[model samples]
Target: MKKTTLLILLLFSLKSIGQQSKLKITIDERIETLYSVAFFNDYFLINNHENLYKNTLKNKLNILKNHKAVQLFDSLSTKYNFSYYRTVEWILQYSNFPEFNKTKNKADDYSTVSENKQFLLEEFKDELIKFNQDTLFQKYLKAVKPLNAKIISQVQNSTTIDELPSYLEEYYGKKLNSYNLILSPLLHAGGFNSEIINENGEKEVYALLGPNGEIDFVPYFDKDFIETDLILHEFGHSFVNPLMVKYENHVESLSSKYFTKELEKNGTNQGYSEWKYIFNELLLRATTIQITRQKFGNEKAEKLLNFEKSVGFELVENIVEILKEYELNRHKYVTFDEFYPILIERMK
Candidate 1:
């Protein structure tokens, strides 16, 4: 019995180490911004996001539209919208565009970049040529090739890439030990999105970085708060969105009858395609506030809550109160999967 128990402990130790090893952070300016630009081409001027493009980023979008690459990417002769998005996703996931990946030799630090500008441009064109023989695409690549430097420079100037990973591990990483973290921070990538994937028995949380459509990253630099809140909020989705999938029926059963037209309209304004997004936002809002309170005390946490409220999360405080109860006696509810049903029932 003693020998068997010792073997089990050894196996558990190895599993812990293996889980920790899966967290990775990649900052690639070229491919990341390329993905962003391609995404802009796909969605720019479309009804869902048309107002956004016209109001805040009209000038940038106009200039980008004239770029050879944007023209070619936007002019794709595809039957379905999925094909266009799929093509860009394929490039981002597989192309491995080296121009952005190349970085100057340094002490192997997080901030190092390959500084050969001319070499970077040449490689950019060469890679595009390999990907497609279209002359228009090649022109697009050249026109926006210079933008990569601008994007990378902005990222380098804004914050240390190292700080992102360190904070993730320090604040909520261990608490979220059930899943692996995959972070990709990109420049000029408009808007943020996250998803959780379960492979076999392991779950991985993936978060993508995009341009701040609301505020410029530099002037609004409350690095400790802004960046931390963004990570917590996105990572919060990993925790809550999965529980949503598990309790889909329970969620749908929450009579949509109670949702006022204004509420439905508000949901649409919040960019939610369905009621699930509202639920996810509520949970994330509460989780972020709770975590902020844990780290910075109630005063700072209250300030953050107000900030969120001013930005349209008026329901946040009420939602936090509901989550606080579950948190206070957490052992009774080990995972969010266990706690959510009660919260939903109460909301109904």
Candidate 2:
């Protein structure tokens, strides 16, 4: 009886670990608070779901809109190119307000921040904390708590989140410490991702995603949106970006030949102004197509491939073909990094 009980306990422990290994989908309070401030400051006014917040948190927005920190954020955004993912990345570096200490360090492989901007963040730290305290940001978070819970529940119930970690690990040949899929209602349709490399060299990747639609004023996430493509593309960056950096010279040489003026204009409009950015996007989009093909089949993959071409990644289908070669000859290449040179060579 004792031996049988021990075996059962061991099985349960292993099951728990297995469940933990899957991607976690939830809303981040820190992100909610940060974007609330940005929304009040009129930063993301162009694409943000302004009516959702305006209808839901009218009283809180009325009070917090005039806060000193919101004013500072508005001023800084006007003074510099401080918009979009840069603002989100900066907020993710800090602890939840009140303490608001730097959670990320220089050694961390996160977003790039200019020295002047870094100084400004340091200068603004105290006021940020004060804004959270005085404006009762926690109350604002509380108001949206039900919506947050609903969004998380909707995503977590999807099969795609369960499958993503294993798929990413199998393709990239590296395991991340964790995958955090954060639901950010304040963001526009686009998503942002970044990696935090700990001192122990373990990587925790984060994807800040927005709602696909809304029901009444509450943010809604359809299963289709939570499926492989959106989340996969974001998480793919953590794997592909580093490899691009490693082979930067080769990528740079090939950029001028492939990254044409029309492509450049389209890419810049989408915030991928640099060649390296376009390169990363191409590789990631191509990989997503491959992943879709493997998981769903060829028709869906073809659809995605054509969609990418329409959006300016004309080279994506070619990259997808190369990735197929890598997939078929995994014993020879072993990892995507090992097979990366072949991609560069093929581009040449």
* Overall lDDT per candidate, in order of appearance: 0.49, 0.75
Stretches of candidate 1 off by over 4 Å are 1-23, 39-69, 75-92, 98-191, 195-204, 211-222, 255-258
Candidate 2 C-alpha lDDT tens digits along 1-348: 999999999999999987774677778767766676777776653334544555555564577677777777776677756666666677766777578877664324543446666666665567677766764665666667776777677777765668888888888888777888888877766688866654566666888888766777667666655565688889888888878889999999997788899989888976789988888898898998888788868887888888787887788878887887899999998888899999899889
lDDT of 1 by residue, 177-276 (tens): 3322222222232224332223343344444444443232221213444344665666566556667878877777763743456555666766664666
TM-score of each: 0.57, 0.91
Candidate 1 — worst ten consecutive residues by lDDT sum? 104-113
Per-residue error at 209 for model 2, in Å? 0.8
Model 1 TM-score, all chains together: 0.57
Residue 130 CA displacement from its true place in model 2, Å: 2.2
